[model samples]
Target chain A: MKPKLVIPLLIGIAFLLSACAGVGFRSDTSWPGLTSDGDTIYMAFNQAVYAINASNGNLRWSYPAEPERDRTYFAPPAVAEDGTLYVGDFTNGIVALNASTGAIEWGPIQLGEGDGRIVGGSTVTGDLLLVPSGDGRLYARDASDGSAVWTFPAEFNEPLEHPIWSAPVVDGERVFFTSMDHNVYAVDLAQGGQLWATRDLGGAIADSPVVVDSKVLAGTFGNELVALDADRGRKAWIFDAGDWIWGSPAVRDGVAYFGDLAGELHAVDIRSGSEIESWKQSLDSRISASLAISEDRIFVAAESGILFARELSTNEEQWKVPSRGTFDGDLHTDPLVLGDTVIVATNGGDPLLCAFDVENGSERWSFTPGGSDKRCRSG
Target chain B: MNIGEIWDILILNPMINALLYIYDFLGPTLGLAGAFGLAIIVFTILIKVISLPLTIKQQHSTQRTQALQKDPEFLKIQKKYKGDRQKLQEEQMKLYKKKGINPLAGCLPVLISFPIIFGLYGAIIRSLADSPSPLLEFSKHIYSSVSSTIIPLDSQFLWMDLGQPERFPIPALESIPIIGDGIPILAIIVVITSYLQTKLTTPPQPGSQGAGMSQMMGIYMPLLIGYFAYTFAAGLALYFVVSNLFAIGQAVLMNRFKSEPEPAGKKKKKAEEQPKESGVLSLLASTQESMMKLLGIPPKSTTQGSNSSESAKDQSEQSGKKKADAKGS
Candidate 1:
């Protein structure tokens, strides 16, 4: 080739080779979304669910016994009172695993053609497993046999085509949920009938609504935290966040604590939907996970993989745990508060599920899910 | 670090950070979707302005070569070394050295910009990653200044989702039985602008060695860019359209003011008597040529001699026939 032409062609070839080498670019490697039951910490990472000893972070057992192509878990496992762990996967539908043994109890259940991959953890309310799918439908399956109880929208004559991304908040007999269609839906759990849907909030809602008092408080793409009458779905109040809220607000006492995409953590009066002037704080990192509240402290994980623990009342930072392993990953899963230890994990390269002392943010035990550092990725 | 890691740290990361920085400022006022679309246009303009010097040099380099190809002295040397490919290459180098025109200058910029283009592509992908993992990777590149407005970037921009391939915004239009979302408007713009840019910068060289290659690039480049715009994110297609249009405008403006005239001399006058070559060769393959030069790489053309060789053989034949005809007279 002519040298003039050769230069570009060579660069093109180099790029092609680099692209080919990137075939294994696991940029989406699942982070540890933790679920705790007694002494076992059920950690979901990449493509498998692990049961780790809460004390040492040692692998106890893992579901699927190995990572399957269709079983990558991105959502945290929801543990029920009966020790059945309800978990969602990227490709595989919701699965029910024995919490202690990591054994498949009833599922890998298909939710409408099995392609409606679950990205949100299931809500195990009473006898039904409320699994949210990307297809905008919430599938209610029997917790015992994983049989279909009912699927919202599918039961309706004209099924809504919007994705129900956040896990449905089951309040009493009613399930309050948010959809990418930019509305909050309140439906009767048993009959699968939509009781009411609020007016278009002008933005999509990807975070779950917190049922505080009689209001369903949810954050939205329009950078507004809207409070609606939980029973009638009446719009009560709206607080403009000035940035998209990817993480749902955590309500404590009368204040609603939430972080916006701009890294500003706001404390709003849930009753009035107004920001509390003294309680607002800016962390300067993307916060995409719900705030994990424990006792008097509120645990928040940023997309920077840093976990911040602050006093719930004063909004004063107690301690901040810098990202473990590589700082490239995000802590999408809410930090888990188990007694004195707070567990959190990152989602990118060498994802580390680390446990820190809640009081001082001291590292306790860290675990790597997919690496060959330790055995037992499977149960 | 490996090649992939190196690419991310150096090229992809910087592009992502720069684009996001632009997005962060515009997103708040324009809405997330509009912010991304506007950011791409602004970024394209920034890159164009940064490489403006090379753009002017590429134009000057092309014009000088066009003048050289028509010189009688250059043609005489071409005729002398017509049969010997090696001797022709040596003589061409000497001629180029004497004239002080770098044949590679036209293309060095274009070759250099490829990494930036690839980096921009990677940046777009990373920034639009809505999922947790990819979003996490995107966070590492975020500058502290724009760190807060980084996530949940509104993908919806007007009628298109900046993150996904653009489709018709109107439901009725999109539901048009067979057409299904009509055509991608940005992709169409990319194709037209790309073709115009290619035509303006690489106008068909009638009888040069690069004619076939130039013609091939003219068709393929626009089609390739159009295909990407059709299939990839609307934000990327928007970038393509803006950059191509900017280049077409720049080429027109730069070519209007030619570089300082080559000092006139005896050798230059003798060269003016020769038949002017039809094709004006340029290494302005794409916007990337000058970029490559900025990175300190001179993309030399081996075909410099070959392009002239075909014309050299013809000249030799014509001269031989002229002598025979003179003897007959």
Candidate 2:
């Protein structure tokens, strides 16, 4: 190629490829709901909450937690020990409601100074909910009351201009999170103190960290699985994949599993940090949402709104949950796991948080929230 | 200033005025004063024809510089002076001098066209949308106030006005069907024609530039023109369509007469067939001329030669082509 022409052509190809590469691939990955606390099902579809008994595929109680007309929820609710539900809203702030009565606890912990949505739900370590903030800060709220405790402001650490987009993880006293800075940081959960950060995490970390064998495993935008020692925050190992790894990690036994934006399910050994097995799923869109894995099956939500399931051992096709035809607010409201029953929030049309029978992906019941002024009145 | 206001001054006003001027020039010729279709065509053709020299210069320069695309010595210099940008540029200039090529010659024509483009834009803004300023109003008035002895600009052309596209008015619906829609059938047609024109005129900028920018430009420029047509008056859109078609015609015309080099070894056989009596005659009378100084006589006048055969060839070939051509004549 002529240098004059090649110079521009290479530049253009590199630019286009980088842009497209940054955007994760999509296949048949769906997370109808995410797993929280290994049990208690917490799903959000415009703030409707359905408690499905984890042991049985039965709906315990469902309440339509009122949401602002302009706002929507992007992820599932974080459950407190006292049954206080903390969830992020698209237009407003972090909301705390009584889990049982679905009653409002206090004002939603509004993020930032401007008009921006709380992009993702909070992750709780203690009374502090260490949630990723779109305002570019990790916020800690009082677990008892929906009050701000402290904030860990985001910082630039990457040579390239990649931004932080994933959920944060807490390991021991240190909190591990990924940023556009291209580093995985282990910060003190209490004071936002930097314990240790890997300089080369290779792309943004949109996925929340998964702790297994005292090692932090998280997927990055570069489609790599990075394992770091939980206490010291040293790099354990790295596994590069086909595309971006935006979805959060799911750990089972000694095997750590995560889905990439490329719609491929990867199972890596926690000890060696090597790919034990990999399965490709033909998803229509990228899996930006987290993966909800049970003992035998893993559920992934493709950006195309289709919920895909596969047997973990055999990597065989399970069942798929179809999304509503219109208006998908956000699909990564992690599936709620209540033993044998799974509750998921549905996007499109009138949004609702629906419960499904675990053994077979069947709709148990649904609770739609929004367009109401009444705050939950709990006794 | 805000972006909208900046666009209004630079892009909007100029484009409007150009259309309005063209409308006056071709309006009566085609018959309709308000429809303005004929004015648009004439103006478009005029703009393309006027920019012919620039386009040709750009194309010729691009072709001449093709040999510089993958020069090994160029690559060596680029590598040797990788970090030193100034030195790299100096080396590049030296290389261009050696090959008798201008690096910027290709881009200069395109860059020169930007000013005319700005004028056309000014014409588009003032006349079509009727949001006139001192500059645009001055232009419109100046065009209108021409002498009777000179060519008078008019708005009437055929069944349509030079200022307007074909608009179907539904009395029950509203005053005009396309007033607020921001896109009309005529505008879409113009945008599509402009896009095709761009594709035809633009040297296929090698596939490496990614379809993103070019593809984006292809799609986006049309979409942008369409959007403007909907928001602005029809006169500007008509101008765009006319200008694009003119470009297409110009490209075909210019390319048809372009020069090419002969195939290898064909000239050597001819040289052997009609051998010149003298070495100089052989060099000039035939196409055996290699060195630039081979044609220049008076060996004492010429300073130096570099090739192994340069000194011998220069002395022997100095005084021969006249008798050779005379014999042929």
Candidate 3:
């Protein structure tokens, strides 16, 4: 590495790998996913779902993600265009967040301990949701209000394998979901009809599937890239990375990108499953955080407390920015980049929500949910 | 139970109340009970005492190794044969035999302490469960069996509930902004004081490799810990600030008493460096050179000169007076 080139290279690599590097949030209570509908940005916390202004990071409103009495809340909240936010909680059913206000419009959709995945962000399509759950059922919940639209029973009965591993992917009118049971489902959005299901991709599919055109691209704990046809629910192409792929894959244009536990990020063509660009950057640790994608850029957040931003086209380094603390050991949040500011969250230390100026990689503002030292004094 | 009573059962119970009670049976004046700085002070003292014998052993082993390899000829042989593993091992054993240096002395205590900390953690969890510990089956009884419910075993000095110190009233504090409640000023003071505490206690280590190792800890460790202290329970932060101060005091005392060897000709180098500084005010003129090193850089201003430049104006006056005297003479 040349003297001038090393820092730039490290900076670029760090950004892609930095997002997943937080230690666990202050408690099991944390908002793991942040998503928006242009004007409103919704974050799921331990017991509440917070809505912030997308432009200024201001508090628009906060809705409770969990039951009123129970402490459990959804880790991620999903936003739908019809002004409904689909949120999950461990104890209560998934509640619908009013798009304008951070208020739950109806009683939450309750999940049994078997249905607790009612707390993660699910892909929303019209009135249907292919909801992944901890109880092993991937439910199709009504997006309008908290209603049990339908649920696909798992092939197996084991609890761990049954729990929802990651959020589902929606391609066209079909929804795709992967689970710990090592299965992927492609169900029709309108009728909750099972088009096809593929589960033999080897390891668990904790990494949510990313949809590119007609194919759903998913990485497996099995360390293999399994692509399922959105129309058929059959195998499209599988690229084996020879390491555990714990995080979700990102799809932009026709390239699907993701890294394995072995720390190799791959950019593969969605059509043929052929590797387009493969870049290896060693952070000397494991990565389980999901990959976030913009139109031209791909960002992977690592558990090493570093975020690596890479140019999607070239797979080249762009910038690496570090946070003030370690993200939770498990990287649960997926950051969304809006223009120059990338709104990201870490569960470790005190910082909860941080907006980074994408151009200079400086923090625009830090929004902490009251667990930092700065908040300790009467200040 | 109030926060103090809870903390008393958790952290204070096992370490302070229990330890003091045991010590009391041994003596008449166990005056170490119920002090503000007691927990941080005593635990640090225990760590120092426990590590002393190992520290002495490490010192002797290093000294002995130096003594055996004192001969330049043998050292030259080892350097010459550095690539040969067999030769290195032979040289190492020969030195060990000659100097009686145990190869594995330094790692023994650390390896043993891991289990001790683990056990203590288990005990802390059990105590904090508001239940009895499994190990010292009686520690449950110790908090329960011991008569007295004055502090609720969880009282804290301020907003902190010492018993359950992890959860402070951080949400409430940040809610009260500086403009409205005048708490942000206090928060700023706390951050600065603890940051200063972190800065003073943690000396700068060397090299990027050292920095890499220190990336998660060492210098950054104190800051990270201080950060948690600032945000976490006040009792823990109070414990940490007092602890660092105690550690600094102990380090200073130990350094004065032990006088660890510096560069062999350090005095000569200081004499050499002073002459080199005589002409170069540029090196010390900037604020970058004057301000103390911190984890994050201070707000930078290119226009401001360092204090050394301000002092340079004063020194020039004395020099000018001397020049006048020389001209008069």
User: Which predicted model would earn the best lDDT?
Assistant: 1
Candidate 2 — what's its lDDT?
A: 0.56
Docking quality category of candidate 1 according to DockQ thresholds: incorrect
True contacts kept of each: 0.07, 0.00, 0.00
Q: Find the number of clashing residue pairs for candidate 2.
A: 74
Descending-TM-score candidate ranking:
1, 3, 2
lDDT of each: 0.72, 0.56, 0.54
Candidates' chain A TM-scores:
0.89, 0.72, 0.80
Tens digits of per-residue lDDT, candidate 2, A1-379, equal 3334544654564454233211111111122333354444555544444555444324555544443455555555677676777777654477777776557787666765533345445677777886665445666777777666766653333122222345677667777777544567777888876777777665556556777788888777556788888877788888886666666777778877666655677777889977765554556565655677877988776655566667987667687665333224335445555666665554432334545666787755554433322111100
DockQ score of the complex predicted as candidate 1: 0.10
Model 2 complex DockQ against the native: 0.02
Candidate 3 — which residues are off by over 4 angstroms? Answer: A1-31, A65-69, A112-115, A154-161, A277-280, A323-332, A371-379, B1-329
Question: How does residue B252 of candidate 2 score in lDDT?
Answer: 44
Where is model 1 more than 4 Å wrong at Cα? A1-26, A113-116, A155-162, A322-329, A349-351, A370-379, B1-72, B75-102, B108-130, B133-329
**Ten consecutive residues with minimal summed lDDT in candidate 2 chain A?**
A21-30
- Residue A101 in candidate 1 has what lDDT? 83
Report the lDDT tens digits of candidate 3 across residue range A320-375.
Answer: 66634444333446667877777677654356676777765676766665434332
Q: Output the number of the TM-score-best candidate.
A: 1
> Ranking by lDDT, best first?
1, 2, 3
Task: Count residue pairs with overlapping backbones in model 1.
Answer: 18
Model 3 accuracy (lDDT, Cα): 0.54
